[model samples]
Target chain A: MHPPRDGRGPADPPAERRVGLILFWLYVLLYGGFMALVLVRPDLLSVRPFGGVNLAIAYGMGLIASAFLLAVVYMVLRSGR
Target chain B: MLHETSATAVAIFAAFVLGVLWLSFFLGRKGQSASGYYAAHGQIHWFVNGIAFAGDYLSAASFLGICGMIAFTGYDGFLYSIGFLAGWIVALFVIAEPIKALGKFTFADALDARFQSRGIKLAVAISTLVVSIFYLIPQMVGAGSLIKPLLGLPHEVGVILVGVTVTLIVVTAGMVSTTWVQFIKGSLLVFFCGVLTILILGRGLAENTGSLAPQTLTVRPDGTRLVDGKPQERGHDLRPVGTIRALPERYGSRRETGALGPLAYLATLEDSRIVTWAAKKRVDAEGTHTVFTPTERSGADLLKPGGSFKGLTTGNLADRLDFASLMLALFCGTASLPHILIRYYTVKDGEAARRSTVVGIAAIGMFYVLTLYLGLGAMTSGALDPTDTNMAAPLLAKTFSNTLFAIISAIAFTTVLGTVSGLIMAGSGAVAHDLVENVLGIPMTDHEKVRCGKIAAVALGIVAMALGILFRNFNVSFLVGWAFNIAASANLPALVMLLFWPRTTKQGIIAAVTVGMVASLAWILLSADTFEKVYGLSREASVVPFSQPGLVTIPLGFFVLMVVSLLTARPAEHRA
Candidate 1:
């Protein structure tokens, strides 16, 4: 059978350990920030009685943050490789 | 139930299913080999795999459950969407490369890659099956739930239909067919939901003044009490029907009160109206069982977030911490789900796995955003079924047009199909690859392994059908939360530590998996929610302090792994 294309083998040291740690911390930061937003501005998470649920905007903010984190991780890992 | 079946909707659904099966069958020729059947020969294209990721990830819970929750509960439901999408970050950055580089078929393959210990394999494999089975229950339940309203058939029949169809698909084409089927379902689900959302926006909110007010019923000394002319008593709920009373204008601050036009209704909530229920006393020859009547809430009390978490706001720091812990479990749980992890194997390589995850996240994220609209729409449309939350979105479509309702219901059926196939595939793989091959020390060739897996697939399908029937009354999405808890607890610690922590020993991995799985399962069985919902017993009888097990089981897993690894440190050193 052909050797796996990715250079790292099963026995090789994990190449993305640092990246994984960075991502983990970034996740913690984003989660904390969102929770803080909810605590400080409960309105952001609340349903607007007349209009549509305003929480969509908050979820939108989350989506953007996740995308940004994903881009950064991709760049770091690709460059490292 | 009023409208006759639309040929176009039926045709669309049938064509969608058949088209997917055809593509899977055609491309699945390559999968005739053993590895191909199990893992697509690990050579799938990145883009195809990416779309397939959407197929595998967006299960019945995401489509029907989250939307239904949002329809009924407001922002709390959207939390599920956030948690689910957040998990991909873990998958992409932490798991994608390592998992692809390490394992061949099942998750156990990866966990036991460095340490070929039978103990590790046994622990991981059992965890895989447990998680997969728990996940399967919801999907099967969803299948039965959708079939009843969609085809107007019995629930058990729907479960059997899905079981047989999914089994045929898996046993014949395996992962290749399963992946394509998911891709099609994913694409259609996103497309239709987007279209539906646009339709909702275009129509806007409108006052249903012309429509008759929903009938309200009450229990009295005589028979059932009727407020107006219509049959008002809907199940165990009583009182006036509450709806979105008004909408906000140009800015979020300005509230417009009145009967909202169809489009404007999207933004309106009835400040003076609330939906609540009163307990009913049922008298029989044997005894009297309490019944309930759905009611509407009017006043300031309806404005607050209520339900299960009410105690948390007042309790000690631990109660507050428990809420955060539940959220954490949900966020991390998606990446750790066995059904999801197995999808990585369906693709060609690490790159494919990563790209697929990106696509899955995008599709899933967009759908979640639309769920806000769908839920809000249902809430105002007066289509809220107090009895069945799972039917919220489809019923919202029904209020708009019978044609839309038919189409949405068919798509919901496909959602069940897509998710159930993936769960069954994962379960079968665990049985064939991990339990039979690795744990049992079966001396079988690769071809023989594939054959055994197909048989296992059939067996799992049967079990799923039975469980689906047994758990028909439970909410499909609520059932899914238990699966997420078990998966996150049992799998995440071992998988993450093995990939990142060099000091992680074989024994540590095995112990962590065993402890995590058992702890979460036991905690769930003993929790208040299970007591009330599953056992039909009093919540006070529950031994567990909190209903959600993630707060306890997750940290417990990490703690067990660390302590065990330290004690077993000599194993690794001695090997070195």
Candidate 2:
């Protein structure tokens, strides 16, 4: 079986668990903010597709959003620690 | 952009290689024992290990390949960044602590911790080698590609140089020097890439994009020209001349008025139209080689999906599923990679592993963000080499200043050095620690094991060099996708099952790993993409139903493990 929740085995609250949770929210907020920007100015994500999907816009937005999300998680984990 | 090689580049390249060798030799003293050589005695500093994670993780595919892809294909390239980073979440949340808690030296140790079985050892060792070699190819290929432009050396020379240097590093200090070298390279790559991105954003975009001078075209053995009806070169004789035209852009009012800012570049492209490759033909000795050539596409045509997701535009379920499967492979593959998994062993504890991963994600994420800007910058820079997409970023740097070009090239070379060292170390560890010592029961002293590892390191280095030379023309990033697919299919199931599943027997682990590895390998070899790209055969002839095997092979591994464990459970208990 697993260890008790006093920072042992996989069951305990990791010192950084709160930090991870906070980071997740922070990422959502940041991404939300970016999405707001895109909504306000749709041009930011606009790119002329070169005969197909404009992967540039798709990926660029994806990265920004993902980075913000990752940062949120990282920050949450850090704060918890 | 100038084709001339710089004195600064040569000096930097030489110094970087020499510096690595110096560090290796200096650290060679401590790596005398097998544990010290393989895992740095599990005492590396957290910060250093974190950066080394960057080094081990960031291969030529990340540096040259991703940047080149972005420069050529735009956002499609940055998908790699997402896939790579997402995988780390799995590493951090799932694999990190448990792996550190379980084993040492190699990935096989963790899986075999609960049960001691020769079958498990052999299976994991084989999987490790297969993954390591698949991962090794792009590094070697990128090394060769970088050498051609940086030192003006042939592709084979670069491959041999990397082989020799990485072999020296692994043979001398094993993980210690490899970690340090990776740490240094990782730090410099991110720092320099950040600097480059700032420069790109600062410069923004410009109108009348300066066109790249045409690359020197090769004469086909069939006496045909790649361009119009030009005369073919007899023998190896050739002349450098500019021929290809830069595709013109329909300058919207914004671009016509003045240079574009970062946001304007993307905005204008969305509003205006750009020409990209569609399809073209070239005559060669084998026959006519049909390749995609970008043309001016607009409106709905430009909006449609191409390449891997060509059917996505039609909203077909199967096409969407294929796309999702590709992304799934990429996302999970990173954490499951053998080279990456073994990196956790370099640190002192689970905390270090976690912390280092954070640093890696930060550095790697920042660099990837910069890649989008750099890629967009190169796309419009008009400095892109039509023939050599790999040179996009460095060539873009050359447009601004020759010194930046030199530094970027040198750093790119170091990029190859850092990743190749990690792969060799992983490969060598499999041979020495996993196969020979653990599986074969080769009784030897620690020092002897270290010696054997170094010998294996040299051999693997040679093999990487040969493959690098052979697969010089294939896209480094594309080849990396195959690596990830194999890694995810073969390694992920075995790792996750071993860690989470209680009934997972040693026999089950072996069967899953063996079946997963073989199934994935066979699928890739027989896939339509492989048939067309590597074997130069008709796609219709391929037996594999899908180009990617992860969706099938991964689940198959889990099934095998479940069935095998249930069948063998009582038999094993009776035997005991």
Interface C-alpha RMSD, model 1: 6.8
For model 2, residues B1-576, the per-residue Cα lDDT tens digits are: 125567887887788889989998999897888888989989998788878888888788888887777666555576676666666766766677677877788888887877777788888888888988988888888888778777778889999998898888888899989989999999988888888877766665544432222223434666454432344334322222111122226543334424445555455544444444333445556556444344444322332233224544455554455555666687668877888888888888777777777777777777776776776667656566666667788887877888888888878888888888888888888888889998889998977998899889999988998899888877788888888888888778878777656566778888888998899899989988899888978888999766877878888888998899878787655364
RMSD of model 2, in Å? 5.6
How far residue B122's Cα lies from its native spot in candidate 1, in Å, is 1.2
The runs of at least 3 residues in candidate 1 whose Cα sits more than 4 Å from the true structure, single-residue gaps closed, are A1-17, A36-65, A68-81, B1-13, B209-242, B247-308, B311-322, B571-576
State fnat for each of the candidate structures: 0.13, 0.04
Interface root-mean-square deviation, each candidate: 6.8, 7.2
lDDT of each: 0.70, 0.71
* Top candidate, metric lDDT: 2
Q: List candidate 2 stretches off by more than 4 Å.
A: A1-81, B209-218, B222-265, B277-281, B284-294, B298-308, B314-319, B571-576
What does candidate 1's lDDT look like per residue over B376-420, in tens digits? 667556665554567778878877787788778777877777788
How many Å off is the CA of B109 in candidate 2? 0.4
